[model samples]
Target: MKTKISHADVLDITAPSGGTTSGLAVLIGSLFGIAVTTNVAGDTVAVHTSGVFDHVKEGAGSGQAWAVGDAVYWDNTAKRLTKTTTSNTKVGYATAAALTTDTVGRFRIVPFA
Candidate 1:
């Protein structure tokens, strides 16, 4: 364990263009996580890489319904979560079922999911 670094549940990284907000999803390169603090672009912000969160999800006409344990992906372009895997980063699994009309759902953040 001597070579171990700090616990990685939270990471400090430079914010991307347009900045990042507290309690929102952030996708840097291939790494995806939830912002733990708000910061302007280029500034360092703490991002939580794990745990359950309630976040915005693609809803209704544009997306499909979700069931608990369903794989979830982060749609950075739309700044929301979706069940669609194409061109999206898998962040975690759905912690709660979400109807097609639901805009937000419970998500469990799994590192490198």
Candidate 2:
């Protein structure tokens, strides 16, 4: 079941695409039902399953420990589900920040267990 997001212990996530290093983004729920910004880059869900991926914010261990049901976002512009596993959680509604900078991209994450 989707748990109402009263609060989220947000942790900045990072991923490495072509090896340029962008900011690790996050989309925590706010006081309203509005999401930070969905598919700003494209239509991709950003992170979905799991895989050995990289991040723009976190360092070396970005996607190294990717477990099943984890959210994986390899490309921001595409907004696609890169990876996911059995541990996936059905969140109430996913969200993303309104890209302070175009370089910042969007907050894309999928829960990984």
Candidate 3:
């Protein structure tokens, strides 16, 4: 018997209230993933659960600097990546160094269900 199913790197998730947009991060409860396709609410959309992704980082004033291996979290309300652990979900870690003024940061998604 094969107990293994899929790789789980990508999953089909129902779009939330505002739906999901391609190339954007969506958080459904504690589980979050990067939308691979855009879909309306209640519709199934492909979401990338794992792997490295370039996402919008919290950039204000001098912005937030992230070094390699720095922990990253998902700010649902802000709909972007942040270093603040409080009231945020642990998404992944920084794969590269980011400047304090950088608008985007590269990070690896640490599949959390």
lDDT of 2 by residue, 60-97 (tens): 32343333343434333432223332332222211332
Q: Write the per-residue lDDT of candidate 1 for residues 55-95, one digit (tens) a residue.
A: 99999787589999999999988999998899998899999
RMSD of each: 1.3, 14.8, 1.3
6-78: candidate 3 lDDT, tens digit per residue: 8989998789999999999999887888999889999999999999999999875646899999999998988
Worst 10 residues of 1 by lDDT: 104-113
Instruction: Evaluate all candidate structures by whole-model CA lDDT and list the values in order.
Output: 0.91, 0.29, 0.91
